[model samples]
Target: MKDLPADARPREKLLARGAAALSDTELLALLLRTGTAGRGVLQMAHELLAAPVDGGFGGISGLLHAGAEDLKRIKGMGGSSKRAQLVAVMELARRAIGQQLKEREVFSSPGAVKQYLQLHLAAKPHEVFAVLFLDAQNRLIAMEELFRGTLTQTSVYPREVVQRALQREAASVVLAHNHPSGTVQPSRADEALTQTLKAALALVDVRVLDHVIVAQGNALSMAEKGLI
Candidate 1:
């Protein structure tokens, strides 16, 4: 890094150009700070973002879905403090998005909802059924993981979803879940469950805004796909 011209450095380039101008590796290098004896920080960053075959998370989004053990597999992430820092930063990202939803209408930024759900659920080893309760203005009231099941499927009860919505006094809700199998495509059973929940909620004057399916680095909005 020192041999590289001052202006060419990540910190310098970021200062001159802006964070968005930096590549994924450059952004990561800024966080990583330094590398081991033989490897440089930039090289370490490159390795960290490399494909699974190369012992990396594959990309920034993939890293977001990585857990403590996953971080342990990386070369420079062995230290407890570094792992803790990465975990804390990821949690902050989730909280920041949650705050944004709380302040504005949820659908006003549909992508945010997908990102929020991914941050919360995509890393799981098993399936999870969760819901976002929203007020009349469509702002998020609360999000809850109501059920958990096997890798392939989850046994969700409409009655429980309805009860939670009532407890939150929500006017509308968004259903979401993760496919640990890395598929964002909604199954027939997923569609059936959405319809079942929609009808049950409608009985109590609650609206089903959308159902989002999340996987590593991808998300599908059922409403966007005309499924909801």
Candidate 2:
């Protein structure tokens, strides 16, 4: 490896120093672990950089769903190397998504909550329901995934929601769910569920801020529409 050119070497330097000391290509090479028949891991890293799909070629979250087979189709990626790269990318994305929410007012207004939820949940292919817990000042305390299911229903337990809020010591909360069909209109069930959950939470001194429905590129607020 010492005989290789500067760009062709990464792992050795990374081990000698630290990951933060390496460039983007070097980092990618580390993730890749090995190269194709003619290309080295570092070389493949450069290729990925030049053709980044979403955030960048090496954008962690962008490649979360990409398989090793897909990586193999690239010019300089092979079976083992591709698998390693894909796994590394997925782990990076998971860590990034699991990061703690910053200390900010998560939902001071209905519009703010709708905008924030739309960034991720709206584009998902399946249903995801989230509950955002806030304090008296409307600062975010916690955001929890309440349910995951199909278009029709998700097992929403009002008691569990109330319990979680009390555990977090939140003074207010907002409910959010997505519709994969790209329509932001609230269904009858959505309305009914929001009402039921709101009534339940009120007993515990936690105010329901709004119930937001997110779809492709659009979001609707129940409070804004006089529903909540």
Candidate 3:
């Protein structure tokens, strides 16, 4: 890094040409600050992004999905401080996306909705059932993880979901859950559960806008699939 020209440095290049001009490696290297052992910072960033084909979370998106504990297993990330910085950045990204949904119609940016759900649920090793409560105009009111573990129609109580929707005064909702098996395909049980909840919520004047199934780097919209 020292031998590189001033403008060639990540910090200087970012300031001069803007962040968009920097490669993914350069952007990551900026956060890393320095190389480790025999690896240069740029080289390390590249390796982390590339990872390995089998069981490795390859690329930038996958790296973030790897989370803090997974990152600890990687070389050059022995320092807790470095891991903290990455986790902090990921949290900021979540909040920033959440704020956008709060301020605008959640459906206006469907991709953001998927991304928000992914950041929150995609990394989980177990099943998680969550709901996004929405106002009259479809902006986010609040999101809650209402249930966990096996998400059967019986296990995920409709009574609890209806209560929360009422508590939030939500007019509509988006249901979501993560598949830790890395398969985003909604099961027959998933379809049955969505229908069960939709009917239960309908009694209270709440609409189930969508039910999304998420896994690492994948998502499925029940609404889009005509399963809702």
Top model number, TM-score? 1
lDDT of 2 by residue, 63-166 (tens): 44456666665675555746675667665554443332334465434455665676546656689989988888777776787788863334788988999999
RMSD of 3: 2.6
Estimate candidate 2's alpha-carbon lDDT, on a 0 to 1 scale: 0.71
Segments of candidate 3 deviating more than 4 angstroms? 2-23, 50-58, 65-70
Kindly list the per-residue Cα lDDT of model 1 for residues 48-85, writing each as its tens digit: 78987889887877787777777988887898876776
Better of 1 and 3 by TM-score: 1
Residue 104, candidate 1: Cα error in Å is 0.6
**Model 2: lowest-lDDT 10 consecutive positions:** 54-63
Q: Please, what is the whole-model Cα lDDT of each candidate in the order they appear?
A: 0.88, 0.71, 0.89
What TM-score goes with each of the models? 0.91, 0.57, 0.86
Best by lDDT: 3
Query: What would you estimate as the lDDT of candidate 3?
Result: 0.89
Q: For model 3, how does the per-residue alpha-carbon lDDT over 107-223 read when each residue is reduced to its tens digit?
A: 999999999998888877789999999999999999999999988998999999999999999999999999989898889999999999999999999999999999878888999
How many residue pairs clash per model? 0, 2, 0
